[model samples]
Target chain A: EAGVTQFPSHSVIEKGQTVTLRCDPISGHDNLYWYRRVMGKEIKFLLHFVKESKQDESGMPNNRFLAERTGGTYSTLKVQPAELEDSGVYFCASSQVGAPDTQYFGPGTRLTVL
Target chain B: SQQGEEDPQALSIQEGENATMNCSYKTSINNLQWYRQNSGRGLVHLILIRSNEREKHSGRLRVTLDTSKKSSSLLITASRAADTASYFCAAPALSNTGKLIFGQGTTLQVKP
Candidate 1:
């Protein structure tokens, strides 16, 4: 039942530095998500959270990126100052809230913004 | 900004043969999901098909949808080698806000 969990699987920062990635959803699952995939691309959608609010973030990609969940079970995506295409791979997903479920993802972090 | 495109991006079968992947999208969607990633990990849903539905299966995987050609297809019969990996197709925009949108994947290689 523990299927969504992510935290520093890999992260190498540099360009302006400031990174923070963490996700822990699966327990109660209230629908949390954040996705990314640079190099070669095709894995986007960058915001969603149904527990602590924030049901959508219009695929966040600017404002230095920033995501939080606070009391929503777990979620954090902060990419301040980072650049160099912001490296890639930083997924985290969860589901089970409005039905039509099945999201479950995590084991991604691999950010490298040299 | 990616909600379509996925085809022969890569594929090499052998194990038990049988591997097909194709997905194409642009707009209007309510469901259509398929995911499986290996090299590097994360992503593994593999089947959703909604939007009125057209076909779906799980065990050996088999999905097909063709909303007037919006496109969608994913077979995976006897393949193995853990079925190689990298196969994605997702959708959920049209303002539903479920936020999905993904494609650009296929890379399957089951050589044994």
Candidate 2:
């Protein structure tokens, strides 16, 4: 089966600019998640979506960061007025609803905010 | 706060040798999972061990969990140059959100 896929494998933007990253999860997967790994840091959770509804968003860094999963098929994460610290690799993962622990990750989008 | 912490941030070994990595977590969990990521690639799930079990083996990989100490260890035997990668251990939070808490990861280099 095809694993999760992300668009724009690399993104470079300036501070105060806006950027959006997209993720298309495996077909029929009910659980989708977002995570980020900053330079020299661990990969941290961002949010999770169960189908169309968000299951958890406590990991979202701030209001400037927004994530949406329309029609429960794919997801989009947008950073408005991005900050320099926002530069990192953003990963998207998916798993079956019953097997949430075994996640399949996508090639991350490396974002560099200058 | 970070839940898992991996030991020996980096390791290097020759091919056909054995490599071991350890991970410790703060909170209780129902299961722990290991993932591997090659350079510039996404993470690939390697194995998962539930709390009720103590040890699991998959091909050349062996995983042992110690609930009393809240620590887990991963051993890769007969390693090859292709085994070079970063290994991460993850566990679900106590909140039931299904969100995984990951460690900083252990980088392994197997020289051919």
- Per-residue lDDT of candidate 1, residues A5-65 (tens digit): 8999889989999999999989888888898988776888888999889988987989999
- TM-score for chain A in each prediction: 0.33, 0.98
Error of 2 at B83 (Å): 1.2
Q: Candidate 2 on B67-108: residue-level lDDT in tens?
A: 999999999999999999999999998876678999999999
Q: Please give the fraction of native interface contacts (Cα pairs under 8 Å between A and B) kept by each candidate.
A: 0.77, 0.89
The number of the candidate with the highest TM-score is 2
- Give candidate 2's error at residue A18 in angstroms: 1.3
TM-score of model 2 relative to the true fold?
A: 0.96
Computed on alpha carbons, the lDDT of every model, listed in order, comes to 0.86, 0.94
- What is the C-alpha lDDT profile of model 2 across A1-114, one tens digit per residue? 888999889999999999999999999998999999897688999999999999999999999999999999999999998999999999999989998877889999999999
Candidate with top DockQ is 2
